[model samples]
Target: MPQPRSTRIAVIGDIHNHWNAQDHLALKSLNADLALFVGDFGNEAVEVVRQISTLDLPIATTFGNHDAWYTATPWGRKRCPYDRDKEDWVKQQMALLDHADTGYRHQDFDTVSVVGGRPFSWGGPEWRFTDFYGEWFGVHNFEESAQRIQEAANAAAHDTLIFLGHNGPTGLGKEPEDTCGKDWRPIGGDYGDPDLAAAIAAVKASGKSVPLVAFGHMHHSLRHTKEVQRTRLCIENGTVYLNAACVPRIMDTEIGTQRNFSVVTLQENQVTEVNLVWVDEGLAIASTECLYTTMKVTEHSASV
Candidate 1:
């Protein structure tokens, strides 16, 4: 008999409260072993968890800037008042966010485990831009985020797969437009950090095989997948990176484009395949253009 297929991981990016038909379709069709969410599930962590749990698959998540809005204690919840009717609606939709903090303490964050005989791990709390959202909702700085990544990496066993953060790995695959040109104006240079870039480079230089590094922070840079250095930046590496932002295409419009997610399948320490599902168009098989099937290290004698 043929060998049974290895585990498949479904990865979703930035579901910013536009969860609806397309979202449901993607979830139902993917049929993944576990659903990895790259954060931004909106202020209602409860609802995000509830809706996602319906898939009946294990979930791993990180916090996005928007998700950090609900850090206040119960009494403080009243400070950010909402319309009674709308508040009632939100309350009824889901209740998982109410326990998100406790859940994080117990479940998600920097860690590692073996799935289908493949080691997998992730880390995040990507840079928090402002306190306008909430104190607990933002990461103090990029350095802190990178440090958490390093900690997770150190904890991972050899031959393990590491998913970096909710944000892309600094320079790789990041677009100047997404970072500095969102509002049709030149903000500055690329939005990614140089330090994060160094960290990823170090991982590549470690001589250990890391196949994927999925991420999602900048929404506009979600179309094409790219390969950077020795690692595939899409889903093929199991160490591949992606930006699964689920924001509406246009403000105030219910319909949108590129409503998508990824499915990763691994077998015997190698990434066999990656499937990208466009909510409306079914599955698009991704090509391994820049994927690294092997890594080479050179040793040289020191010259006098």
Candidate 2:
């Protein structure tokens, strides 16, 4: 039997513990084949991960830097909101996810495979948490990190791949408002993961068709200027890179409470549509803003 050629993917960006029963219900109503999560599910939030674990759809997730926020550094540990010694929040969250955690790994579907970039990455040129990486992944440096990601891509059973990461790969843009650009002071520099970029090159060199790369660390709202939002979509080298970090994914509006989800449609092994959608409490699509299409970037794509 021939497999279906089209897949609708719903990306629930950096949760930061915003997930609830309503979001879960909204996801079920969307009719998406797969749900992608870019982590930051709230400082190693075990409860949030537990809720995510019960979702009834296929999923691929990569842990964000915030997943390891409290465990990565001495300062963070000192300020941990939860008791570290009594309960390992990170371990519990990972355990809840099981195979859903795709960092340095790949999850295969019928037609396409979702491969992961580095997990728990702060997304920059610098390597911040060596000890944490060494203990968990045995990856000591950027080279090893690149190798791990590339190896995962190479192991994919399918040629059509979607690379998911906590943060995007480098070289998309250098401006603070770029998808993965650094927005803090000394702002004008790439804040994407270099290892992920290396892995992408390797994957392409090995002849895999990379349709899309999705991540969420840099929020869409710009810290530099409220006049403009971050670049949420970038198309280059036969790939579509997206920043799905729609902060406060749950927002209260005049109409009612709206939940956001970045939806990407893959057809014939190509990204055909990308949109930032908002769903009302009734699970109805309240708003739809098209960000990308096979033909052209729609008017809705303008700094939205």
Candidate 3:
């Protein structure tokens, strides 16, 4: 008898305290062998886990800038170098983390793996530079993060997948443009690390395609952009990068608006399709396209 083939993985990005919404969608539409969350589950992290626990699939997650658990230590001290308002919101978040830990220990939830392959993974929640700007910005050292990703790739079989940090591989997906020609640069663009970019390049160069890399951090655009320079590198080496940020206001707002998440489908070691599903006026909007063919990844990729 042969081992059962891995089920298609569902990659979700940036659920900021929208646990109820995510739970509804997951119950209604999410069908994968594994569910991968790219980060930013917010204060409802444990609730999210509780909802996910109801499913039979394995749940893998990384920390976004807003995870909150990483900011406060076990003894209620600030582990990260940054400051946070632990009033109502912090207390709530810490409670959720405590619940999540208890659930894990009791075998009521799935395992939460970080970058370094440790019981908790590499890089502190404070290492991310992007978290410094109101939102969860800077956390984790990109170089070390990249190394861990590479190690995971090397160790896993052909079917193993990876969930990247909020900051994606540089040049792996589309780069958001100054569509309005305005000079309002987002916080991520300013604090984005070049070292992480190089590390991503090295991973692709290693010749083991990561299959799927999901991320958030950018909340404006829901579409994939061809502006990613590292994507070219991945194509040359063989990997697919998906930007799964689900911001619903990108289409309606002028400055920065668009809300959607990437529903990525993978089968037979290739990305079959990517759907940018947007939520508009309490309804779901979607745009589907083939990203990679049986032979090669598409060259005429779309931008956000």
Candidate 4:
């Protein structure tokens, strides 16, 4: 028997406790083969868990900043890590899904494999620079985290691989509107994680056919602007990076009207189409584009 060549994956962005019955219903209606969540369930972790429970599909997820707090152990003043459970609550809650953090785990569906992990760069309720330099609260380590991603990508047995990270890898753009883009009006620079970026580059350079890399954390647009559809997707270096962080810093305002969710299609080890869907208002496609062709770029590529 030949393996399945095409797969439809419904990628859900940062719920952050803002997801309503409409959002939940929209997810269930997608009828996708796999449900991939980009983390950030937020303060309503329990309620969010209950909501996703109804999806009734093969699910895979990575931990987000908000999710860390909900799943962490009450040890330090800020629930760092030296003494904590580390999203064990969520793991127990979503026992039926493949959850990866600090390392990578793959879910096989015959022809394709989805390799995902909660890149250990900037996560947890509060992220400090020291967290990546050394070890914050005893869990987050940049070097180790990047190394794990490389190892997992190397060990995978599938030819087609899809990478998932909470906050995407850096180097996509230096602008404040890029994947990890930061406003440089006063102070300029890219806000993405260097370790995550390096790891992603290494995995890609390894000659692995990783066509899709999905992530969340950095939002699309904070202030209301015509660029609402700007940061939702980025196609660079033969890889498609999707920023599924639908909720902006200002919540409840753009929930139903923005492109918060996505349905990504992969065919024959390549990304064929990306449908950025909006669910907060009425379930609809905010943008749909075909992306099977690869475009090469210097260390950094153009983010669509």
Cα lDDT tens digits for candidate 1, 207-280: 65566555556664323333311122333223544444434421221443445566666655455655544544
Which regions of candidate 1 deviate over 4 angstroms?
1-5, 20-26, 53-55, 69-79, 82-141, 173-184, 193-198, 203-208, 221-239, 249-259, 279-304
Q: Model 2, stretches more than 4 Å misplaced? A: 1-4, 299-304
Ranking by lDDT: 2, 4, 1, 3
| Candidate 2 lDDT tens digits, 1-304 | 9964789999989999898999999998899999999989998787899999999899998899888878988888898988766888888888898778889999999789999999988889898789999998999998999999988988889999999999999888888988888998988899999999999988998889999999999999888788988889988876989899999899999999999999999999989999999999999999998999988986534331
What overall lDDT goes with each candidate model? 0.45, 0.90, 0.43, 0.60
Which run of 10 residues does model 4 get worst, by summed lDDT? 291-300
The best candidate by lDDT is: 2
Cα misplacement distance, residue 115 of candidate 1 (Å): 13
Q: Write the per-residue lDDT of candidate 3 for residues 166-200, one digit (tens) a residue.
A: 54544433233321111134412322334444544
Kindly report which residue stretches of model 4 are placed more than 4 angstroms away from their true locations once superposed: 1-5, 20-22, 70-103, 119-140, 184-187, 223-230, 248-259, 279-304
Task: Return the TM-score for candidate 3, rounded to 2 decimals.
Answer: 0.56
Q: Model 1, clash count?
A: 15
Among all windows of 10 consecutive residues in model 2, the one with the lowest summed lDDT is: 295-304
For all predictions, the C-alpha RMSD in Å is 9.6, 2.3, 8.8, 5.9
Q: By the lDDT metric, which is better: model 1 or model 3?
A: 1
Question: Ten-residue segment with the worst summed lDDT in candidate 3?
Answer: 102-111
